[model samples]
Target: MSADKPKPAGVKIVDAAKKELMNVSAIERDGNFLVVKGKIFGTMPMTAKLSPEEARKALRMLSPGLVWFLLTFPFRRSPEPPAR
Candidate 1:
């Protein structure tokens, strides 16, 4: 590690699957890995397991605001159901 880049501190493993799925810069040491991630909007941290090609394809499928709108759309509905 260089002075410009600091090392990550190791925390006890929670769940291996959870750890793997987390969005973090990870380091492997002594047969274990430590991951550091940030929470987005108090929700679960978002992680990308997709390859670059897959990610690019996904990004091209939606407009910038479309994803956000779809995610938030369910919450913007009326309290009562619409009559047919």
Candidate 2:
């Protein structure tokens, strides 16, 4: 990695203590791969390409958590509005 070249968003570390959050802007299919475009910490642009197998694995891992969230979503209270 050269100093002049910017690091890839996935590997870049902004703050060690703070948790990094990726805000996915778009997901596009490029041929046989899936291209994920997002911003890390809501600022740095990131792009990731995943093969079919990788996408399936990611789906399998995320499905359970997504299902659980959907099942309990109605019961969960919304966050309190910020004071003016």
Candidate 3:
């Protein structure tokens, strides 16, 4: 990809300095597993497969945070009224 090209929709890996180190190309569910495909330092390809149990654990960890975000979303912003 060209340096000026927009990156595809995916996850980004960053360090403590917030500098991007890698990019995840895709994440998909296959049967009972979750598959993640990405690149290391934008060059080396890597893939990870998560089993159903692992997926469930991930969901459990994320659910509360997700719920809190959703619950507070409406109050986080006030939409401007339409111009008269």
What TM-score against the true fold does each predicted structure earn? 0.26, 0.46, 0.57
**lDDT of each structure?**
0.51, 0.75, 0.83
| Superposed Cα deviation of residue 48, candidate 1 (Å) | 14
What is candidate 1's lDDT per residue for 41-82, written digit by digit as tens?
A: 334654334455665787899986999998897789635645
Prediction 3 global C-alpha lDDT: 0.83
Residue-wise lDDT of candidate 3 within 1-84, one digit each (tens)? 657978578678788666778889988888887898999888889998999888678777767879799789868874565699
Pairwise lDDT winner, candidates 1 and 3: 3
Tens-digit lDDT string for candidate 2 (1-84): 657866344433345444667767677899999898889887888899999998688777767879799899889995675799
Q: Highest lDDT: give the candidate number.
A: 3
TM-score, prediction 2: 0.46
Give the distance in Å from residue 7's predicted Cα in candidate 1 to where it truly belongs. Answer: 33
Any idea what lDDT model 1 has?
0.51
Give the clash count for each candidate.
0, 0, 0
Give candidate 2 regions above 4 Å deviation.
Answer: 1-20, 59-84
